[model samples]
Target: MDTELLKTFLEVSRTRHFGRAAEALYLTQSAVSFRIRQLENQLGVNLFTRHRNNIRLTAAGEKLLPYAETLMNTWQAARKEVAHTSRHNEFSIGASASLWECLLNDWLGRLYQASSNLQFEARIAQRQSLVKQLHERQLDLLITTESPKMDEFSSQLLGHFTLALYAAEPAQMKADLNYLRLEWGPDFQQHEVGLLASDDVPSLTTSSAELARQQLSPLNGCTWLPMSWAKERGNLHAVADSATLSRPLYAIWLQNSDKQTQIRDILKTSVLD
Candidate 1:
């Protein structure tokens, strides 16, 4: 299928103007119309209802919009995957901020320096984004703290992440009305460690775990950060031992793509067996 033609259709759908869509594509209006005509003829369906100054998708075009997006994403994923091994020895590994700082680089070093053909791409993304990339067949492996189980993917317990309370100085707030900051991931809000509406400490919310610490500032506040980040930047100190609030981390990859030996070895050595 002509992906560009589908893209042109989408642009026309968005702008609802032939000339504007042509300008966006760097094509003349005549060229745009011809492409649409060729598409309509090939599919035996009129994709648009053309009016004087604007265009609207016909029922037929509207029906195909979702499929077109799927195809485009699939094609892009295939292109990325194929070029991965050829242009550069490539594997994409994804994680949230916790893993990004904790162990992501160690894995990259093992993969990159061990083989001259190897290229390591590290992705910092959330669970849904990582799952989407995996669905698109764009990722070789993914590590997340969430215990997401899918029929098509294989998951193993890589390790556990333990979080602790850290502060630059002893908190000055009343013991009952304490403020504890924590990240968005399992480090803080999991049902097992519910700090959001706890009777113990009235807490603050943030989109990033790092932001949680920033909100704490020098005030009588507390936040749960990855132990690794807190230790090196000694401005913060752990107020309590962290054995209680730990969550399991998983090393995950799609089962169908599991046969890649290089990726398998790298993942085994990096996170899990």
Candidate 2:
């Protein structure tokens, strides 16, 4: 199977338009169409439903999406491994955006300093997407708040972080201040339900703490943020009498990963502080 055809298929799926995919791929629209046709012919299934301007992946295409991503990632890793002339080992690590901001970003720098021979590719994504990539062998390690309960993977408790309600002003913490809810995971959700009033409805909800922080000042809203982050920025202050939540972070990786030695070495260097 031609990886180029798969690449074309992926781009088309992403953009949901042949012309746009062609433009992005730097190929003619006719060439993109031909590649899709070739891939469909080889697979004996229509990958997409074409209806004027509306294009969508068929059931087969939906099923093939992860496999295609895995294949492309594997191919890229293989090419990198083959092309490298040094003794360095390359590993891909993934974490959620909030986790990267609060924890993994600093840990990654320390990891590099500690393990000079190891090269890392860091990706920030939602936990579900990261888990999918880890399952598909696209990612060597994943850092997340929730540990996946799968037998094929091993989960280790990395550290814990405290989340506290913060606002630009103490007065803004009370009354009709816009409440921005950060999705910290299921545990935090349950804890939040207990902390907040039943009638209190969040003005906005998002997965990224950074996004919530960005919107906080202008709205004079209160949101749960990592204590470390809240302390760093002088503009934000902790809400008095607000409940502080402690969330555990975990490092997850496949149990039988080929990069076990390298992964182990990297894990040793990870420091949450």
Candidate 3:
């Protein structure tokens, strides 16, 4: 109930000594003991086991540790959001680096003066972690080229994203036909018998599409990249013969969230139509 009492409790928990906690909080040792006693009284639980000059958390205090920390974290985040609402109306969003650099900014720019508080924090992470944070409500939206299939999470498909295969030098592809390289992913690892007639496998592979794209330029390795990223590359040239790899991307969020309106506007403006 009392945030100040909780803060003091946290300090006491930290030092495991009333006197030290009092020193940190700029309160008298007696004052610290009194506050903790008041808190224990309010909760109907003993939080500490006092021993002469030593103290340890009671069983109750141990259980409350996680909850108390959660409360403080929630309070801190709420305080931040309230402050931001008065100034920027910000929401923390997460996405992969490619989405943040190219797609997110483009949409957020026109999001509006009417909704001046509507600012987004684009947090970057790999797919699995980003999806986890989204479910945890630590992130408002996840922008990427993959559609997450979790039942609890939902999606609004923007469209299919086409990826292009490119060669380092124009001559490499023009010079050879056996240069097919596999994109690293569980499904993509298998050479579709139709796509490859050769008994030989890919020359090289890497898990990161971004890295695979980077490797495409200097080495004679074949790699695929989102068409948007690859179309502008100065050195790498697209293989017109390759099957255009198009993935359906979504501006995904947790189901039944009211924040979807704010999320929707961002998606509409940012994703390629």
Candidate 4:
């Protein structure tokens, strides 16, 4: 199938008029009609039903809409990735800001040691944005706390980390000690609500654990943090009953990707090891 025909079909679908689509594509109206006709002939179905000036997509056309757009976007992304590969063995990765600061830095070191010649592009985004980018083929790999249930993706365990409450001093039961709420997701919220006093409120709330860490000393506050991170700071100590909080990390990638074998090996040998 000619990609141009699909492109023209999408343009017509967007504008809902062949003449306007032709104008947008810099093609003659007749040429646009010819492409649509060619596509209709090849697919053995009428794409659009015409009634004078009013135009509407046939049932067959409506069915093909999503697939057509996906094909075009995938084609464009493949072309861009091919161009990148020609220049260098580039791998694009994305993760949450907290993950980047806590984990991805070490993973990058592992990547460099595995293949010094490989080029890397790393992005820090929330999990939702990372999933979107991964689906669009904009990111080759993701390091996240939870596995994506999408069929097109594959995930592997990257080990687990404990999230424990930490403060500038030893655990204190005082409500006025300046509590900072760290957003760790819904599970954390559910686990924490029962632990807090009914009228107690945090002095600060933030999504970034690093920000929480920075504020802990200044405000003389307490917040949940990964044990590995918290242990490094001498002034901070774990709060009472914080040992139960732990979550697994996952390394996810597009299933059956061109770099699947290489990524599998890299994750197994370098990062996970």
TM agreement with the true structure for every prediction: 0.58, 0.66, 0.57, 0.63
Off by over 4 Å in 4: 1-85, 174-176, 195-201, 270-273
RMSD of 4: 9.4
Q: Report, for every candidate in turn, its global Cα lDDT versus the true structure.
A: 0.70, 0.84, 0.70, 0.80
Q: Write the per-residue lDDT of candidate 2 for residues 228-265, one digit (tens) a residue.
A: 87777667878765778888888899999888888787
Minimum summed lDDT over a 10-residue window in model 4 is located at: 264-273
- Candidate 1 ranges with C-alpha deviation above 4 Å: 1-85, 171-181, 184-209, 218-220, 240-243
* Model 2 superposed RMSD (Cα): 11.9
User: What does candidate 1 score in Cα RMSD to the true structure?
Assistant: 8.8
Better of 1 and 3 by lDDT: 1
**In model 2, which regions exceed 4 Å deviation?**
1-88, 171-175, 194-201
- Model 4, 143-262: lDDT tens per residue? 887877899899888888877778777765435357788766545577676446789777788767788888987897778777776666566787664545777788899897788976
Ranking by TM-score: 2, 4, 1, 3
Clashing pairs in 4: none
What C-alpha lDDT does candidate 4 achieve relative to the native structure?
Answer: 0.80
lDDT by residue for model 1 over 91-185, one digit each (tens)? 77888765666556565676666666767778888778888898679887888877666888877787875666666565432242345644446
